[model samples]
Target: MNFGTKAVHAGVTPDPSTGAIMTPIYQTSTYVQESPAKHKGYAYARGANPTRNALQKSIAALEDGKFGICFSSGMGATDAVIKLLAPGDEVITSNDLYGGSYRMFRKIYEKFGIKFHFIDLTDVNNITPFLNEKTKLLWLETPSNPLMRITDIKALTTIAKKNNMLVAVDNTFASPYLQNPLALGADIVMHSVTKYLEWP
Candidate 1:
């Protein structure tokens, strides 16, 4: 099915017990088990919840990825990805990025020994000099916040791949509707669902 069809029906189906068409929110904290080793899918809310799983599965399907993990907030997701970089690993990122991301990378991650260098990603040439073995991640924020500057994802991905670096794109502005970074060769794509996906 196309993206539009998948968006509407990919992660949800009729409930087997009640025959409800919409995906019901599984709001409980825990699920009962027939035995200690054998269970009925869910164990705890923190690890997994039916509602959250639906959302995560939908997102992963939309992005054409194998897995999806939802977090309490966008920063939570960002922090999780950054954690993949060990202490003293370098990250090459855009100079004009979201303030929250900047704080996370510069203030928080730096304290943990993760170093970041912000450069003009629009001019792919400027980023080339910074690519090296130590660089673990290439963080891209296209159509950047406040400034709305667009970067060439394909070009950046090429550079990142050459150095065997992971490429993460902040897709909040353009969104999956306007942009799909994974199709353009990005390793990871993030969104601020609170903004366009959920806000009224």
Candidate 2:
């Protein structure tokens, strides 16, 4: 399907009761249930909401990813990816990426015992020396936050995959319209929806 079509219908379904074409924003703390543990797929507002689910589904479809997760902020999404690692696990990331990401990784996750290597990832070879058994993930942000450094997604993913590491890309700057990192072999693609997306 074309991008325009996927953008509209990928994760969306007509409202069952109202038959509204677009996904509705369900504004409530808790959903009504038929019985104990028997709700319409939504239990708590913080846990899951129909609107957020639809958005996540649409973004995932656009990125060609199998699954999607929505978070409160870009840092929240970054935190989720970091949580995938163990205490001693290492991540090699682009030095030119977002400052908030660097703060989250160094200030927050570092205290948790996760190691990070912030290096210039403009050329794929610059990352070679950082590879090791402790390196569990490859983090990237391209058309990087302020620097506009473009890392070759396919080349990086290829190397990371060869070493059995997961590759994650922050596609906020590029957005799904410009690039699909998942299609380029990235294990995960993250976006700061507050920017390009109006639904924050």
Candidate 3:
């Protein structure tokens, strides 16, 4: 299906009980069960929700990704990605990217010992100088925040893969309709749903 068709129908199914055409807002914090071991796929709001599951599926389909995980905010999703690294691991990213992401890298994760190299990514060759065994991830933001600089995703991801580094692209600025980083060889792709998609 095209983006428009997938956007509307990809992960949603009609409610069998009410025959509602859209996934209903599962507002309750918990679900009922026949027994302690038998229940529908949710336990608590913090863990999962039917409404969120539908949204995740729609996003995954849009990105041509295997799965999608929703977060309260874009930063929350970013924090989850960074948590994959341990102390002493490193990341390479563009200096022209999002300010919130920059602050999160420099202020929050740096103290945790995850070193980030902020450089000019417009010239993909600039990333070569920072390549090292310590680098565990390559983060990219195309049509980047504020400056709106574009980075060549396929070119940079190719180089990153050669070094065995996982590549992640913050696609909030470009949106899935404009670019799908996973198809370009990024291991992970992130989006702030509130930005272009405009829904949780």
The best candidate by TM-score is 3
Error of 1 at 75 (Å): 0.7
Give the root-mean-square deviation of each candidate in angstroms.
Answer: 2.0, 2.4, 2.1
lDDT of 3 by residue, 1-200 (tens): 99889999999999766989999998979877788958787787888898999999999999999999999999999999999999999999998978889999999999999999999999999999899999999999998998999999999999999999999999998898888899999999998878985433
Q: Lowest summed-lDDT stretch of 10 residues in model 3?
A: 191-200
Per-candidate TM-scores read 0.94, 0.94, 0.96
- Please give the range of 10 consecutive residues that has the lowest summed lDDT in model 2: 191-200
lDDT of each: 0.86, 0.90, 0.92
Residue 111, model 2: Cα distance from true site in angstroms: 0.8
Clashing pairs in 2: none
TM-score of 1: 0.94
True-vs-predicted CA distance for residue 168, candidate 1, Å: 0.7
lDDT of 1 by residue, 69-178 (tens): 88888889899999999997999988899999999888888999998999988898998777677998999999998699999999889878989999999888887767
- Cα deviation at 101, candidate 2, in Å, is 0.4
| TM-score-best of 2 and 3 | 3
